[model samples]
Structure formats: C-alpha cells, structure tokens
Target: MKRRVAITGVGLIDPLNESINNFFARTIRGESSIRYFASKGDPVPVSIPAVYCADFKGDDLLGKHRTISMDRFSQMGLVAAFDAWTNAGFNVHDRSHKPNAGVSWGTALGGTRIYEQGLREMWINGRERLPPLSVVMGMNNACSSHIAIQLGLGNSSLTYSVACSSASAAIGEAYKRIRNGEANIMVTGGSDTPLIYGVIRAWDGMRVLSPGNEENSPSACRPFDKSRSGLVLGEGAAALVLEDWDHAILRGARILAELAGYGANCDHVNLVKPDSSGQAAAISLALEDAGIPPKDVGYVNAHGTATIEGDPSEIEALRSVFGRQAKELAVSSTKSTHGHLMGASGAVEAVITVLCLKNSIVPPTANLKDIDTSCEGVRHIRIGDSNKSDLKAAISNSFAFGGSNAVLVFKST
Candidate 1:
C-alpha cells in the first residue's frame, strides 16, 4: 500500500504578507497588492503595474554574511524553507541530517535579477567589473541547492522549471517520492524573482500584462471578470513540509491537511494558450489518484490569470470535469488579489487551498465585479466570504506557459 502524505507545515514570502495568518486575513478582506512602477536604468524606458515584495529584507531572514552571496530568488526560498522548518517545530539551525529527508524546488526565471545586473555591469563597464559570484548566484538550481545545504537534507535535492506549473510539479513530485517510500519527509515548493527590467520587458512584449490605470492600480487583476485585461507579474516564494502520515503521527506533529492526489500533463498544442481537454484530463487524473469522484471535491482554486483566453479556457475545463455540477462548485482565483507569482503561484495557492480546507471558508475572488458570460456557470466566489461546514476537499490548479498543467488535491485532516 502507498504511504499517506500529510502537509504538516507551510510558509510564504508573498507580497500580501509573510505570516500565513496575516496573508489569509488580507486575502479574506479581498485586498489587492498590485502596484505600478517605472523602470530604472534600461535601454528603453518602460512603466507597468506588477506585484512586488517590497518589504522582504534578506538580511533580516538570513544574516548579512549568508545573504551577501545569495541571489534574491535563493534568499526568498531559504527564508520560506526556514519558516516552514520552524513552523513544523524543528530547529532552523539544526544541521543534523535526516537520512530520509530531501528537497524539491521549482523556478521559471531563477536568479534573473542577479543575471541582469551582471550583464549590465559587463556591458556598461568592463568584463573584470562583474561580480565574482555572479555565476553561482544566477544558476537555476541555486535556490534548491541553498535550501538543501542550509537544512542538511542529503537524501535528494531536485529542481523543476516547467514555467507556471513549476512549484506544483515540485510538490507533486515530492509527494510521489514519499508515497513510494523513497523518503519520509520533503521540503518542497517554488520561487521566482522575475520583476527585473529584462524579464518584465519580455513579458511586456507578450502583451499579457495588465494595463492598469493610475487611478485604480490595485484593481488591475480581475480574474474571471468581464473587464479582465491580463495578468500582473509578481515575485515571491512558498514552501511546505510534507511528511509521511505515520511519521507525523509518531512525532505528534500538527497536521494541516493531507496531500491526497496530484496530476500533471502537457497541452502539446500551444505554448502560450491553454487547452481545455488537457486541463480536464489532468483534473480527472488527480481525482482518480485520490480515489474520489468529481462530486466529492467541494472547492477549486483556479489558475485564473484574468487573461481573456486563460479564464474562459479554465472555465471550460472545469465544466468538462464536473459536468452539470460545475454550476454549484465553489471556485475562486486568489490571483485576483495577490497577482500571479509565476513559478511560485502553485505553491502559494496550494498553501491557500490547504488553509481553506482547515478553516472551512472560501476566500473571495477580489475585483470581480462583472462575471463574463463565458465564465458564468461555475460558482465564482465573489466579494464576500463563503463558509461551508461540510467542505471536505479542494483542488489547486496550475497551468504553465509550456503547455504543462499540474493539479493538487488536498483533504481535511
């Protein structure tokens, strides 16, 4: 028999707030974290509205010496992983390696900020002027490597870069390893700091970013709404501590929820566009993995990026999976408030999904004033909170740019 997995702890370094309680409270209030900013030191000047982690101080989480050599993305991941470790009642500085513990992290644009700065220094100045640790700081696996080193996890350390589904894939892969008896515990999630000048300029060229008006910048990301324009890029990291159910019970750890199932697939059709059939297949596969049917899931955390095509495609996928019951399923996209965190979105949303199961309350999809006709049937959680005493299970969906999709099923513990 497969071992059961329990999500014992979770952590976040998001734009809304660092503390989980504070973040959930702000989410319940439907507050938007999107803001506008002007570019600095670029060949061409640009202005755009995006979600940024303005309050995160790396030195505060990691000492000044440790953070000096770490990139912003790696720093965020380390902070979040440390938070999860502490929250799980483990000492952050305990370097005593656990034989069965490992790490799996994901990132799409890893260390972009440091890479951009390195290029700028090389171009504007001389080759010798570049930072000495530039290569180490800009590597894609730097975050996961740093996390494993800090936590003394020696079993395995892996990284995934499946665009938007990166984090979800990491967590899902970790879940499988534990269930298959390869490890007893895993530190898993994703992180990305893509708000750098070059990264934002690339996204700007794609024309998928929200064009916010100066008067109402906070309301720019309106997922599933009729006036929804596009996604707002955000930066952050989220981490979770997944343990074997028996191991958690043996240690008397507090169980937040059970990771009952995970499903991942590729659209194989378009790079930027979503395929409804592919999404539906992933959802069905997750349900099958969990040994549950469609009617058993009470809530869905959507991959609603608020783009014109993205929202409708997700709605169609839900319709295909839930059939007539789609009209009654409580669905919401927290991106409506926190903006899209890119690679870290799935991990953050998974934390939110587990919280929803534990608290029995569904967070509102902020800024959804008018639901589009194409997204009408599904019951979109709007402006106010909805409490369901019988809420038993929830699914968090993540669809990425490479046509990759990942869905995670969480159940009340």
Candidate 2:
C-alpha cells in the first residue's frame, strides 16, 4: 500500500541567522542578502558578489566537542537537521534507536573548503600532512552520517551529489521512502560551501559568476529581466522533516504541507545548457504523479539563475506544459533575493514554496525590473507587487549542470 508523506518541519541556515518565520518574511519583502566579496593578500585575488552566513557560528550552535571534527558543510547540515528534528516535535535529547527513521542528504562540493585548505598547506606552506580527521570530514556522506548517528536513525543514511539538483533529489527520494512504507520519518536536505577561493575561480572561468560593485551587489542577481546578468554563488543549508501521514497524525504533529509528488529525469542533451523538452517532461511527470492538472498548480519557484540561456528555457518549458494556462500562473525566482545556494538551492526554495502554500501569499522575484520577452509567458511576480493570492499548490524546480532535473510538487494540507 502506498502511504502519504507530510512535511512536519523545516529549517535552514541563511545569511540572517534568523528564525524560519523571519526568513520567510524577509524573502517575501524581496530583500537581498548578497554582498560584494573580494579576496585580498592571496596568490590570485578574485572579486564577485555572493551570499555568506556571516553570523553563523556552528561551534556555538552545535558546541565545540560535537563540531570538533566536522567540516563547515557538515556543521551547517547538522545544525539545520537538528533544528528540523526539534521543530517536528521530536526530543533531541532522546537519542534512542529508531529503526523506522533515516536520513538522506545532498551536496555538490562537499568539504571542498577543507580540501582547498589542505592543498594550500601542502603546496604553499610546505606541510607534510593534513589534519588527521581531514578524510572523515571531507567525505560527501559525512553530513548524513552525522545526522543518523546523532538521531539514532537506523533505516538508511544516504547522500546525493547532483550539482544544483542535489537537495531536491534527496527530498524526492525521502518522500518515496515514506510513500512506499520504507520508513516512518526521514530527515532530508542539502548544504554547500562554495564561496572558497578555488571554487570561485572555477566558476569565474565559466563566465557565469555575476559581477558587482559594493553599491549594486545586492541587486547583482536579477532573474528574467532585460538587464539580468548571471548567478551569484551562496553558502547555506536547508532541511525538511518528512513523516508518514498516519504517523504524524498519531503524534499530533503540526503538518506544514504535503509532499505530494516528485519527478526527476536527465536532459541528456547538453552538459550545461538546458533543454526545454526535458524540463517540460519532468514537470508533466510531477503533476501526473500528484494527480493534479496543470491549471491547478498556482505558483512556481523557478530555478532562475539569471543566465542568458536558463531563464528563457525554463519559461519555454512552462509554456509547453501549461499552454494557455501559463499566462495566469504565478512565477517567481527567490534566487533574486537569497542568491543561488548551489547544491542547497532546491531545499531552500522548497521551504519557501511550502510557506507560500501555508500563508497563501507568493513572494516576488526581487530586483526584477523588466521581464524579457522570451520569459513573459507567466504572471511575473515582481518586487513591490501585492502577492496575497490564495494558492492551493505550488512546485519548486531544480535543474542542475549535468542535465539533471528534479521537480517537487507540494500541496496545502
């Protein structure tokens, strides 16, 4: 028998370090956290616009002993996971074995910062060896393993590293686990710390890193606009607690939203460029999985990286799927405000989408001035616009570099 999955809790580490309520409120207000980042006194200095959680002190949150051997990405993921567990009404102090719960996480460049530091120590500082815990901390599965260990989840501990689609794919798989009765609860999300020197240099080489001065850095990520540039890299994490509907009901958990459907597929046409046909197929499959029609999906949290090719391609996919209904569909890209969180983007955007359904208010695409003609099929939610639409369902889109696409359909419970 197929069971239903419900989202009982959500958590994240963003630039504000604020509560989830404040984060959602600020996002709806179209506020941007991006700032100018310039590396000084380095062998190769790079300047760009990015979002960093300057106030996040993992040691303070997770304590020194617990975070002693974890990498920055692992620390961020564990913090978010613990917050989600507590928010879901689970006792963090009760670390008893739970054979019915598990963890699924994702990251594109897990522990890249740690590896970079080790390389610098060996090549530049003449160090003979890295820290003893470097291998354990730098593993991509470290975060998920830590979560399972701390919570005593014994069903499964899995990790996915599919670039930008990592988190969405993780969340989707967790939903499937609960839907298929494989587990009663699952902690799922993704995190990435991509603001490192080498990471930025590589993205800069690709010419996809948007440029900005100190004054305009906040508006550097302008998606679907005539003057839109490219993506701004950000560092953060987001997590969700998925539970079986009956289990949540038995426990009297406050259900946030229903994770109704998930569809994932490979474009297979290009390594970096997006194909609209593949994207449309994924969207159609997700809607079909949810037993929902195109006209019923009220809003879309677009994976709008503001690149020249990505924005129009996403809009074209929507046009092909929804046809005339696309004209009235509300669409916005929260990346305009939060910047892109790389592998973690999908999880953070999914949280925002769930909030939209709960509050019946859609957030506008921050800094969107004029929509490009190719991206004008839908009702573009722009800054300063009233967004209090009564929405029943919404979808979050995540398209990654290796032609991986994942779409999540969520409905108000």
Best by the lDDT measure: 2
lDDT at 322 for candidate 1? 98
List lDDT for all candidates, in order: 0.89, 0.93
Considering every candidate listed, which one attains the maximal TM-score? 2
* TM per prediction: 0.97, 0.99
Off by over 4 Å in 1: 16-18, 127-129
Q: In candidate 2, what are the lDDT values of residues 1-413, reduced to their tens digit? A: 78989999999997978898999999999999899988765798888999989899989999999899899999999999999999899987775538899999989999998999999999999999999999989999999999999888999999999999999999999999999999999999999999899999999999998889999999999999999989999999999999999999998999999999999999999999999999999999899988899988999999999999999999999999999999999999999988899889999999999999999999999999889998998999997887998888899999999999999999998
